[model samples]
Target: MLESVLKTIYVIWYRELIRFFREKSQWAGMIMQPTLYLTFVGTGIASAMTFRQAPGGTPVDYMTFIYPGIIGMSVLFTSMFSGISIIWDREFGFLKEILVAPVPRWAISVGKALGIGTIVSFQGTILLILSPFAGLSLTLWTALKVLPICALVGFAIGLLGISIAGRMESMQGFQLISNFLTMPMFFLSGAMFPLHSAPQWLQVLMVIDPLTYGVDALRNAIYAGIPEAQAILQHSIAYDLSIVGLFSIVTAATGVTAFNRQG
Candidate 1:
């Protein structure tokens, strides 16, 4: 039984991956916005801005502060809506075939999340490669540390997407709802700006956003060597990791439940 479950997951994961890579347009569309933001926004801000202190109390370059946030933004937007494919599959009648298979709904949900996570991780990794241009170091240690963190961020957001998309019937409805959710989630996450820069109401919202912790974790890991980053991060790496892990698990379980009930 365990073997069968694993097989089901593998199959679902493989199918999603094949669908993604087969479409060259997916890669193009995914890369375009991040490229524009990194090029235009990063450069534009760097030109006009003097250095400022992050909410963590450390003085950081505007580019450095926003780099990780942009990474978080890229991962957040891509991963959170990755499960729109679930709705697509349903519309095309492919999902019915999967639903009828002798596998647990949870396994299928997890598999789909993992596939989307992997794809979005690739997107984040591409941005990471470009980070040096934005003034970050590209060491082996940084790469090793960042890869896992990116994967976690991707998986957590992908699970969040699945939790919504699993039971959704209409592609139009999914897009409408996802657009509504994504902007607030990204903005509140401190992706474009620091949480401390926000008003009190927005700060409270940031505290509730799981992506806030994910962005915080990425920033902490990426900037570990910087003296100011060390000074500002009152919370340890463990705090950020725990929050993202907890969010992923909760969202994944919720997705499974929703999928099971969708029948």
Candidate 2:
């Protein structure tokens, strides 16, 4: 049974990978958005505003501060939209075939989430190439540390998209719902600005946003080498990881439940 489950997951994951590779346009579209934001938006903001509190008082600029948030943004957008592929598969009658297969439905959900997560994580990592431009000093060690956090954030967000997609029959509907959710999640996640000085109502929403912890975790990892990192971190690394991990578990279960219902 374990072997069967593993094989099913592999098949589903491989299929998603093949589809991703075949769609050459996806690479450009995904990479371009973050590049534009990091270059245009980041540069403009960095020049206009002087960030008073540089982590460790080490003169971290606005661009450096928002880099991890930009990575989170990339992961968020890519992972959330990835579920639209499910709608496409359904439209083409491919999902029906998969649903009728003898394998466990949960395995299918896990595989789909993992596949989307992997793709999103890769997209986030690609943004690391812009670290220097963002005024961040990144090394091989920093990249290694940042990779898994990106994967975890991607996986959690992918499961969320899968859970929503499992219930959505139309691509338009899925896109609409995802758009409604993505913007607020990104803004309140402290991606573009610090949350410590946010308004009370916004702070309330920030705490509830899973991406907040994911972004914070990314910041924690990215700033790990800086002195007095805690000055910049809202929570400890372990705490941030715990929240994102819990979110992933909850979303994974939700995705599996959605699949079971659909199946």
Candidate 3:
């Protein structure tokens, strides 16, 4: 039974990969948005704003601080919309065909989420190669450590997309709802600023936003590589990972629950 379930997951995951690569436009948008955000927005802000000294008394620029957050933003947008594929599958009659198979509903949901998560994670990893331009120095060991974190964050956000997509039948409706949700989540997650000094009301919202922890985890991991920045960064690796892990589990269960109710 376990073997069959695993096989189902692999097949679903593989299908997602094949579809994503076949669509050249998807690659363009995914890579373009993050690059523009990091280059244009990041550069503009870094020039206009003077940041406080980092933990070890080293002066840090706004661009350097916000780089990880932007990476989080990239993952957030891509993974959160992974459910659009589900809507597409449903509309094309592929999903209905899969549903009649002997595989469990939870497995299908998990598989779709994992597949999208895997692809988005790889995309984020490729983006990481540009970190040096943001003043982040990545050693072989650090790169190895960051891989799993990126994948987990991807999976967590993919579950969110699946949960939302499961209830949505129309692509247009999904796009509208996803855009509304994505903007606020990105802004509240502190992707463009530090949450430590945010307004109380904003801080409260950030605490409740699951993506906040994911961004914080990315920030924590990036800062871990910088000795000078270590003191100023507030979140510990363990704390950030714990929050993100819990969020993943909750979203995974939510996706499963929602998919189970599907006809």
Candidates in order have lDDT scores of 0.81, 0.86, 0.82
C-alpha TM-scores of all predictions: 0.93, 0.95, 0.94
- State the lDDT of candidate 1 residue by residue for 1-263, as single tens digits: 89989998898889988998999998997888888888899889877776564755566777787787888888888887787998888889888898898888889988888887788778877888888877888666776777787788888778878888886888888788888988898888877777666789888988989888888888777887877755444356789889999988888778777678765
Please count the clashing residue pairs in each candidate, in the order shown.
0, 0, 0
Could you say which candidate leads in lDDT?
2
Give, for candidate 2, the lowest lDDT window spanning 10 residues: 52-61
Give the candidate number with the greatest TM-score: 2
> Stretches of candidate 3 above 4 Å error?
53-58
lDDT of 3 by residue, 185-242 (tens): 9999878887766889998998888888877777777777676666646577788889
- Pick by TM-score: 2 or 3, better one: 2
> Please, what are the lDDT tens digits per residue for candidate 2 over residues 177-202?
99999999999999998887688998
Could you tell which candidate, 1 or 2, scores higher by TM-score? Answer: 2
What TM-score does structure 1 among the candidates reach?
0.93
